[model samples]
Target: MSSRISGPGLGSRSARRAAAVTPLLLAVLLSGCSSGGSGGTKASSAPSPRTESTATATAPASPDAAAYRRWGIDKPLAAPPAPPSAKLTDGLKPGAAPKVIRRVPTSDKVVFLTFDDGAEKDPEFVKMTKDLKLPFTMFLTDDIARAGTGYGYFEQLRGEGNRNSINNHTLSHPNLRTLSADAQRREICGQQDVLEKRYGGKPPLFRPPYGNYNDATLAAAGGCGVKALLLWEATMQINDMRYAQGDQLRPGDIVLAHFRGPSELKGTTMTKMVANMLRSIERQGFTVARLEDYV
Candidate 1:
């Protein structure tokens, strides 16, 4: 999750100069936005396939009117600051290949579901996952874990029988493109280490925060043993809430949702968000399926 600071605090000529330089740097960072990377074939170390899908989503309502409003998301109590470690790197190196994963995509009846930032274990999510026997993938970040909302709460959900898998999302959620090569590896590999210690083994897939990453990010990811860098095909928002993708989403599409939020409107709990998504998908003539079926 990215942070937004409103109003003016830091200012003056130096601030303006710093701000002026940001866009030029941002251009470099944004260059990673392309679905294809340099030379296509996963850059030397053989980075995994990083396919992305884009959709036109109307920005949901701001979080301010959430309390009295029924259709908007509740604004985050305070604007979040950019994650503390969003630095950029220029060095590059190859890493290990993560385990090859398989999905049930050929069925044309199922879809994969992925959630980013396991900020907390929303009971509604646990209940829904259990009740529906849904399979959802979590791309975890240590900061979220350190924030006290780690995966410990969902031990049972991650057990052998459960269809959920916890993957690495980076120790600190940085825009991988912005960091130096070594720093990029540290972010990716460091999180993999964290996942291994906490989840009993390291994750095979890596997804950058906010879908952000550059070739350096991918190269570093490959060095860290990640076979595939996952991306989403679509995200659902209803009554201004986000949802678990597969619950009511469809086949071949990657569904994206979040663990916490700077809500589109206030009072928008995880419960309402998931509900909204399910309703939206069902209305679209498709159902959400576990990504395992796809690839």
Candidate 2:
């Protein structure tokens, strides 16, 4: 979404279009891409399940165009696979189960990209997802999203036809391990109420800050209508991701990012961060999936 980047203006449409070529040729390397990790089951080496680019999607107009080569994506954007037919949630109730989840259990070449907090609300990030037609899962904290009415910014993303889900982090980005179970429930459920009032539904997922959680965190999440306590296999940085296992992205991994702006990125931008994420996925042969769909 990464094979080449030969010029400037990586943020410009023209620059992205300039680095055009079919990247499916690298699909064969997916089998040898990465070793399995604790983050869900390893995804299959095959990349055909999520194929969306038709034969008519000729050169220059590819949906997976190198428009984000500066961000590091070297492959065309392929749609993610549909919800798996069987998984951990097969017999569980819709609104509840499972504590301290790290990732889904499937061999499909699918990973979940989740953004946390709600710091920077960049319009360009919205434009980037819209322009690229990519999808992601958001675990939003109340204080951050409410800053300067930044909730409007997230609304813009939804208004523009992006179908990403919004989940709860907490009222404040607190470390739940230190809080009592009642306090944790308030943090988790308070944000759930706020999100449902704003985004139209209670979030099915909940993530503890810094991946910190305990037995109390799980019990609190269940009481607040949260079905899963999500964790991650990778945390995205300004330019690259810190993987829990090997350097490569394993299938079924859940990667984390933030709604940050330039100041937090050491003067870089979130758009660039996301672009590089797509590039990494391209290089590894994995497509992004909807987190709620899997759970």
Give one digit per residue, the lDDT tens place, for model 1 in 1-295: 1111111111001001111233332232212211211111222222223221111111112234333133322222222121111111102223533322212223354445676666546666665555444456777677765555445755545523445677777877766667898998998999888776765555666776656556677677777767566665455443422222333334455565556432321446666666665555555555554443233
What TM-score, computed on C-alpha atoms, does each candidate reach?
Answer: 0.60, 0.74
Candidate 1 regions exceeding 4 Å error are 1-107, 240-250, 261-265
- Would you list the C-alpha lDDT of every candidate in the order shown? 0.48, 0.60
RMSD of each candidate relative to the true structure: 14.5, 13.0
How far off is model 1, as Cα RMSD? 14.5
Query: Against the hidden true structure, what lDDT does model 2 obtain?
Result: 0.60
In terms of lDDT, the poorest run of 10 residues in model 1 is: 10-19
On residues 15-60, what C-alpha lDDT tens digit does candidate 2 reach at each position? 0011222333122111111221122332222222221110111111
Best by TM-score: 2
Question: Candidate 2: worst 10 consecutive residues by lDDT?
Answer: 7-16
